[model samples]
Target: MSHVGVTLGVMAAIPALVEPTMLRWARQTQGYSVLAAARKIGIDEDKLAACEAGYERLTIEQLRKAAKAYRRSLAVFFLDTPPEGIDTLRDFRRVAGSESGEWSPELHTEFRRAQQQRDWLIDLLESEDTPVPTAWSLPSSEVARLSDAQLASRIRSHLEGLAGSSGPTTSDRYAHSSFWVSTLEDSGVLVLHTSGGGVATQEMRAMSLYFDRVPVIVLNGSDAVRARTFSLVHEYVHLLLHADGLCDMVTTTRATNPNTALEARCNAVAAEVLMPAAAVRAATESLRGRPVDEWTYERIASAAVRFGTSAEALLLRLVNLGLASRSLYEQRREDFQRAYVEQERSAATGGDFYRTKARDIGKGYVRRVAGAHRRKVIDSFTAATYLDVKVGQITRLAEAAGFASASGR
Candidate 1:
């Protein structure tokens, strides 16, 4: 068959304007190769290669099929404009070829953004002239001394206070159990999510100029929700110390291991934030006659609900407080995790709730460029590149955000 004939046949079978851009994006985001995507989408190898090279037009049906194969939505595929300004393709190539120890582009970008954000935060604090505590006030060694349980409690308390004062509207932004607070040393939020796996996995985490405006740590939705919460608080302690760099506490399960000083300190900070030892002791004492040793999973769950934490967290607190033995706590944790997994499996869902850095930063940047486009503040190409999606998708997002309505577009 002639090239035109084959192309026409494919077009007739798939009428949608499925851009090869979507395929490239799937490859980048999901770490799939062209052959894998072609096989999964049932597209001919030559046709898929043409689509990636921008030599062939992709039908909307093909785009939807590719989206399904990539486990993403057509809407997400169209959300950002094409890559421009930065050599994203080159960067990815470098990362792919680099040494095993080298950080991923996402991690490198996050590290740079975090450094900038930390510097900005220091400047902000210094500029205030008020008697605010310096980032150095909390010593790293001292921070390292606190137990994980203690640190978790402190973080939780601080967040609870902030949430209470900020009210319900701020709840979504702050009440999110996943947060990082630490002294000024190597401190920043690391938000991650699981993708295409039932087990906890890291999808992407980055620091960007986009999220630098606020000390926010977003995670992927497909991760273990409780584990994500713990990591956030652990990183928050790092932030409180003004520390730099990234740590995958969830993968390491750092809080559970008390041998390492840094992990212990972070665990203490997380515990302090989530459940203050003093408070836990008081609560435990108040529940007189209720055998602390015989604390049931239901009881722990109830405490977790009351304290706005996970049952696993509550059990850990009980162990730390000597109300429950270590063995008992571990058993309960395993049991709870098993049940949680079963529950999630029963629901039959993929992906996670945590927002990736790209999605978060990309969305924010897109919104700004979209506004500029509507106000005639920038050109269409500028809008497309900044937003990282196609021009058509940019228009849709602008309309959804009411930017178009206000600008009479």
Candidate 2:
């Protein structure tokens, strides 16, 4: 049958049954909230929730509304064959709170879809003999139970062993940002740039075990460069604990409360992971009364350059170590941001590379699908859909990885 006819038929057969799944799918695939979906569909929030939970039936109007809302063809909703990689997508849906109703329909859906697509791409790349893993399946939950102090001790011990006389001297230069960023993605952290969102807003959302794959992290696209890095570290902590849900680290002006106990713990873990207190103290001592109170932006910038970190990071480290006051830190932050603005303007770029590069290179999602395809877990068409591209594009990826050309075919 035609794709449209198939979709309509699917809607007719299990219109009510698909409502919850569709609502959940819309949210994850497109980041639409339940309230928003209700508004779009002209249904009351409770009714919409009920509809999504499969407690109520959806009218033909509702089915059309949902199909449009989710940007999916009606046929997609009712394919006789589960779309080639439905399992991963379904797993993502399940893990991302599709069944429990924990997340706002939009966020839950977008994250799951993005993760599924990413995994599919990674799987495909692996089929072409790419060395990348399908996912970074870490045992985060086992480590998350440790206290902040215990985590700190563990990080210090790990660093001490990792840091040898011949190793890189700067605390800031441990590894290239790209290396860690890719590593985080491989570990099932769904990092993406928010096309639209507020400032100082980024999160390490909770893990979901949809389809039995490991948990995933979702970072906002709207955060500043420094904020994004912090978000990555924050989410890494969440992954370690095998926990899920949002951990918003943005400090607001409106006197918000501290994070939840678990979030606070994760924060502590993130700070320790990125900047060890002992390392900071030792680094500070090495400067030996360098008169941090009067240190200029140039001085801080120079130090950051030497340490392979941003000036903002160095200032924060000083504040955490009690070598700089809050007021001083704030002033330095303003100066650094101002300087950054001037430099970025001179460069005349559209956005920060770190913020948008992964999506641009298709590194975030494409690689995962490639990996999955290589593992024979999914077929080529499935890889194409997950990457949101055509089968030909998948072929190009294969060719790029040195596979025999399929161009003549």
Candidate 3:
């Protein structure tokens, strides 16, 4: 062999010297099968099996690849044992038959990301001796006791600033969801929208993490803006109940199923919050005597526009209020579902980096981290890490959050 070729072969033969159980633990915790993990690391399945079994060793390059695939730091593999982390979220997605613990690796990543963010928020608040938001003053037991309408009324009163003098805002759909997110954040809830490389809409519409201090809600940004508006409120309700779960929000309201019941309660609360019964009645008063058939698709879409919610959601509300028949809702909802299925998948928009980052991690979080940095509570590198941006971009991120650049500090 040539001198360079021999050197390369020698380098490739070097072992990573990580524990075999660590490799296996990382793969299993990440929900990756041996074959899938091998494919992700660009190695053969048998080789991965051997490495995990301690029968063989992987090169440092291969170990790095495995680390990337498993979303772990390379140094973690050298630890005495795998880190102990449990799946704290209760799965509420309605699978066809038996419960399958299998979840997409993306979901596992999101779960960890949410937990890390929550922990960061806790630490930040503790450093400042800040009390938890008053929005959570209403305990979960009291929240559970109140009927949906009562809870909805309370929420409306609490967030009435969003409605202004007229009523629900106009058809500026994106602004609608943004407004809710911002308001929730002000109420001491950290709201995050999943950016590119996040979980798909089908796998999860949204999830909530309940904490007494600073609760968190994550929305699947891939869904339609209107859909996300509903999901935001739905997850908000989940927080009110202090129930944290990985949710699909499939709109299955049957009470017989326990998971469905919880989802139904959240859905019902969301409906009342967004489409107050009194407002819905006023909107449909013009057609009081008309048959349910008169509620055409175009009309439903028009009405949904005012509330910045999906026509399907609006229709379901009508059925619940007895303003429309169940049969009519089912038929129209089927059409809406079909249209949703046919809708083109929204590709990630490439644009100015600062605005996108601001939207992803949330303006409230950005402002807080920026304020902390400005006060010398966290350094530039720490601020950048919290905001998921480069240190160079910290100035722009603060600006995006409407704060002056504090990178000079």
Candidate 4:
């Protein structure tokens, strides 16, 4: 192969100078050490160190290898110096008495990736002339005027028509979460249900990010369906108010503080969405004639099933409606969470790539990327990069996403 003083063992080397500052910038931006970055790119540690120190230059081929390992383009290695990194998005998951941890590496990667996807779609929507999305940014007080029950009724009506759930019926674990996810997507909310890194221990339940006039929700796919469903609607509430942040409000609650008033509102919205006061009153009319003190775990779970909600959500509903005392509800919630954790441990893994990414990558996002590819707006490589999947899997992934969107619509 003809070469420009450098060889890649194939096509001619594209004439490019790999700036040492850029090399150091890329490695540092991703929080990688010299030795670690070298190992990642399969390069000699000493050689990489020299490049980063500006003592030696990286050949075009070596630069390409480094670029691939860093998940960046070769042109990035040619920057004059170092460029600033992506802006940090807002984090609104903090609640009183809870540790508000910063983003983990996996979560940070996923967050940045999601933001980039949002960026891509914003460009696409503008060029394609997509209609302006309706933002349900109502004053929280006004929404409460209809009473929480009435607002929930309206949301329920919206969700029922948002997507027609017909997959595994009540038997499947993903039934509830799938239903909400479809409904969310159908209502123009982009839902991403990945496990972030798919790591079990540090899995975040869900997070919402608003961008370019649209809201995107990311749910942890590895979590149990019960918990994921709670997260889904909780984030839906955040999206409604155009509030952007991360949260893990799965199976629990915190005291209402003016500082975290939004979390409280979103929490209430989630509870009402899943089990409104009207529905709760109707369902618990028989139990009410009895006594709140007599409510049992089995009873709460049974009631939860009717509303297609989790026992925790149902318990919260009961407490909010004063049908059950706070003391009893908390006690039952503790028991419920323990049992639920054990059940999740024994339950099978959530879903495979097709079922998971179908919702995880988000149907709204998948269709836009797929359509972009078809229109030559983006190539397969770019599509796969944005999807965090292999190039060959693009078509199948797109099909699954399309099917999901169609099912929801």
Task: Name the candidate that leads on lDDT.
Answer: 3
Candidate 4 stretches with Cα past 4 Å from truth are: 1-87, 93-99, 135-175, 195-203, 250-259, 287-294, 345-350, 368-395, 402-409
**Could you tell me the lDDT of residue 147 within candidate 1?**
56
Of the two candidates 2 and 4, the one with more favorable lDDT, higher being better, is 4
Q: How well does candidate 4 match the true structure in TM-score terms?
A: 0.73
Kindly list the per-residue Cα lDDT of model 4 for residues 18-83, writing each as its tens digit.
Answer: 677778877765556678788887779998888777787666667777887776777767778665
Worst 10 residues of 1 by lDDT: 86-95
TM-scores vs. true structure, each candidate: 0.48, 0.59, 0.86, 0.73
Q: Write the per-residue lDDT of candidate 2 for residues 1-409, one digit (tens) a residue.
A: 9999999777665644453565566545555677887887777888878876778877766767777776566666544333453323211112232222234434544554555555654455555666543244434564657677677556434433433212133434324334345555554444554434422232233233322243455556544444455566666665555554454553222322333555556566666665666666666564536776557766665555433456667776677667777787776777886875564356455744322433433354544555566666788787666655577677555444323332232
Clashes of each: 74, 57, 0, 1
Residue ranges of candidate 3 with Cα displaced over 4 Å:
1-19, 59-61, 79-82, 96-101, 132-134, 161-167, 338-352, 404-409
Please estimate how well model 1 matches the true structure, expressed as its whole-model Cα lDDT.
0.49
Higher-ranked by lDDT: 2 or 3: 3
Stretches off by above 4 angstroms in model 1 are 1-175, 178-220, 245-259, 282-288, 292-294, 343-388, 392-409
With a 3 Å backbone cut-off (N, CA, C), the pairs that clash in candidate 4 are: 193-360
Worst 10 residues of 2 by lDDT: 90-99
Question: Candidate 1 residues 1-409, lDDT tens each?
Answer: 9999998777657655445565686655554567777887788878888987778855777776787766565775664454353222111111222312233334433333333333434343444432333222234575567555554544444454543432121212224432222221112232333223322233232111222323444343344445555655565555555442234442223433222445456665666665666666665564434765556666665555534456677677777667777787666778876765664468554432222323333233334456556657667876665544577667776554345565674
Query: Global lDDT of each model?
Result: 0.49, 0.53, 0.79, 0.68
Identify the leading candidate in terms of TM-score: 3
Alpha-carbon shift of residue 251 in model 4 (angstroms): 6.9
How well does candidate 3 score on lDDT at residue 39?
100
